[model samples]
Target chain A: MTAETQVREPLTLKRVGRFVADNPLIPLVVLLLLLVGVLEFMRPGIVNERWIGNTIKFAIPLAMLAACQTMTMLTGGIDLSAAVAATISAFVMATQVPIVGVPLAICIGLLPAILMGLVNGFGVAVCRVHPLIMTLGTGLIATGCLQVYQRFVIASGSVVPDGLAWLGTGRTWGLPNSLLLFVPMAVLIIWAQRRTGFGRLLYALGSNETASRISGVRPWQVFLALYALSGLIAGVTGLLYVGLIKAPSLSLVNPLLLPSVAAAVIGGTSIFGGRGGYGGTILGALILTVLGTLLTLLQMPEGARRILFGLIILTVTTIYIRLTEQSR
Target chain B: MSRLITKHGWTAGLLSILVLLFILTRMIQPEFGASGLDSLSRATLPFAFATAAMAVVVIAGGIDLSVASMMAVAGVTAAVLMDGAGDGMTVVAVIVVLLIGLAMGAINGALIVLTRVPDIVVTLAMLYVWEGVALLILNAPGGAATPWLRQLIVGPFLVPWLPKSFVFLVVCVALIWVPLKRSKLGLSIYAIGSDELAAYRSGVAVGRTRIAAYAVCGLFAALGGLTLTLSTGNGEPIPGPYLMASVSAVVLGGVVLGGGKGAILGPIIAVIILRLVRMDLTLMSVDPNVTTIVEGTIMVVVVMFGGVIAYRGRQK
Candidate 1:
């Protein structure tokens, strides 16, 4: 009976390992649940319906922004200018709402993001500049342009549109209103990733650019479209974030840039490209949001918080890589 | 002579550009007096060192995003140690700071090696870690340098135009960089950067070379920190605008982004050119914000031109 029990234990362990290898999301979901349990344990009844709603509300904009990173990183590139684009959209839309009303102001605000996207695309596709440097340059230029624009619009005064405010902060049946927007967006992104030709092309290019080019893929067009789409996503996120905060500043969404990249990376998206999905990124964003809550509850100093954040990211990524590598 | 010109064409082009920019600045502000030169040297010193530090790592085929943070850590630490200390103590403090920098860099290299993660990921994590350490050490902007130490580092050596900072830079380049360039380790660095597998197969100590490269980078970053301390007579925990500027300088100097090709002098000259351009814009009374736009535009244009050149070469 003891020998039989020992054999069954090893078999069960092996089966569990195989299950984890096949489903990467299982571990992340487990981690997320564990974090929630920890939070509940710490504060005793802190993890209620309202807490869940609030967490989702905050995680929505971050997930949207990380969507940009997930897509770009799929093609072995990144949009360093995403935060700048988001900030510009939010700042411009807020200021313009008082002058031209909501619809026109929103359209105008999105224009700059698309413009930056095209410029990034042109640099990467046409000029063949490295994506990192290209995005960095454009981000800087956008920030500078925003500052210059601020000098002119300082007198206009900014206002948050009421509709956006409702969408950003309102709740229904214990669920975040932002879900109305994010759910459709997330579904479309996930669907397009698996079922669309462009999505396949992104993976193909990333896995082997030369091979794809030789096989008749137009590298330039894919880059241009991908970056433009990333820009549009960033713009939308900016608008939502402005609504969430109900305030607009020159640096309004800038702080999210690194965190968005971290989210994409933690979601199992490879920085080297061609091995991740928006689904993982969504989970990553939620995990980060919960982690942030935990940190705030701990009431640690800013320095300690930052160090712990970095350390956790490093540890989690190492473990994730090890697990995924074993599957391969 | 022709071969020399062909081999060092980029260097010549960079130098000529530097000269032209200098002449243009001189034309704008005709006074361009000895004090003006002294100020230019002082302003360029920290960035020049920072750029050199970056160039070393880039040439070795790695990027250290935490370099600015390292400068911050070293700068603040030195400030805390050397504040109101005697000359002898101040000197000892400087050495200690440099050693700390080296140790920090070695740790970075080891982390990357041990984790088996990409350099960018490890360095990115380290960037946050080191920045947090800097914040912990000095939450606010306040640390002093003794007047005597400041003079020895930043004051004019013998002439008004040739500040001790410039002399110190030259001495560092001569004593440190030149030796490294001619040494076997230098060859190994170039080899590893160009092709790591090949280098390893050929008996180069790839891991050790990478660690040494990072260590050297750390030392230079520390030197940059010390320069900042001396120039301001106070250490600010903030790394300020040097991070992107140093990277731009490295690229503008002609180092390939993927690594394995470039000269340190080119980046030094590029740093000077960048500073000159800023001075020129200020002299022209352009909105200070416009400088950021111009800097970004310049980076794109220069890289585009390099791309065209490389494409042409490839075709040939």
Candidate 2:
């Protein structure tokens, strides 16, 4: 074959652009936009500054948690302890804020999550425990710890301190501070994913650990750091959550688990590990927030809303799988 | 034979734990001797059914995280249908509820086989879908039951003063055990799970087997839901979202996470153990919250030990 013909046979720039255009997410994104517009039309004040701000504020912690989960999942593992870590972190922040102040408490809050992450990494990477079972065990332990800690120290049905509320419940420039915090975090994560050597190693390890190991990449180190980073993110998000609610309620952790996983998966990260960008995860988070809001507006019961949410993730993942299959 | 013994040793360990916990509970709370055993036995049955249902899919190297949600859907749908339909239609309603479950499972299998999404994500999504559908049908938790249907299925059938639920549970296990162990279909499940590409290339009909596995999972989930409704005689909407953890119970039963190994009996024993543990916690005056923690801890230790043993066996 001629050089030109051979070059053209494989995916070209034009084919790649076309593939992006034809992606299922593109249509879903469009559909989401239309749905938002329709909701706005039905209720003219639906997209007001305050409402939009609150929604963005409510979603930041979860979206950040999702971002962290996306990273671990991209590496072909999962962070089952995200919610538990968050729960523990929130409890620590709430109980300790009176003594340590907001900033230090925030830092301390992140420690539990980071520690859990280390445990996950150590077990899964060094000890070679399967990620699912290891995390399941750790997650349970962390959750139990949160419950025990809360019951012993924190007063039931009470908020910790009014001063600490500024972190989560504060408004700046007509935006939630937690929402503002997400901006820099998201940008930094995005930059790290694209520019850093660590990002490249992560993708390599995820795609083929044995090959990467043979190529002189320390797969275990990368796996450990990735899990640590995942837990760290969850810890950070948990502090943000405490700021938002100004309370330590273990129940908050319960609902957050499935949704974060759903968000990561729906954002196009392959569960088999490797091959997804954080940009899609951001959009995926937005889609999740929008869907929940839309369902509430539609006046559906909690059960129906839940079912629809699960179904949406299922549909999106299926479509994503099918599209990728076809492109290949 | 040694390899087989080592491989299946986790099941024995789990069974012993169940027995030990039961004995411990009797010693701790003599008041709970007979009644506690009965309550624990009843609680264990539903989860046993649910775990067995999930074990099928897990063995096929796929998981049905949505089993609990599917059960919720079936229970709600069946309850609503029975409530609306008069007494004469009870049998048909039962059939319809099971069919709903099968259909839901079929949809999940079709989506997975057709689109080839990872089974975890697909089932996770289906979990939400079924949950939503159940909520739409029943705005809140309320169900009416046909008395005859309830009496026939949910009420205690006596085998000389013994609750028939245990007998029936054992019977279900036997039926599932024989066909899956002795028949070709069962072998195909293990074959495909152990190595999908090899099974497919060898012309073992991987796609069909996977679809059938999910269908059976759904069928079992339906049975669990229906039995639960009958046993309680209350059709509450709450259990669908919460039932996902029972999948872990099956995994704790020594079923390998990625499939291709483990047995139904392991999960059955795990369920019994879990129930007994809960009873023991109560007898020991442990807070209820700690029960979940204990269960999670046991699962971690059991699975880790099991993995180590399996790795060693593989090396040998």
Tell me the spans in candidate 2 whose CA falls farther than 4 Å from its real position. Answer: A1-18, A21-32, A98-104, A154-164, A301-304, B1-7, B30-34, B81-88, B145-162, B240-244, B312-316
Q: CA RMSD for every model?
A: 2.4, 4.2
Residue ranges of candidate 1 with Cα displaced over 4 Å:
A1-21
What TM-score, over all chains together, does every model reach? Answer: 0.96, 0.89
State the C-alpha lDDT per candidate. Answer: 0.88, 0.76
TM-score of chain A of 2: 0.87
Clashing pairs in 1: none
**Docking quality level of the chain pair in candidate 1:** medium
Evaluate model 1: give its TM-score: 0.96
Candidate 1 structure quality by residue, lDDT tens digits, B231-308 = 887777767667788888999998887778997998998888888788889888999899888988888799888987
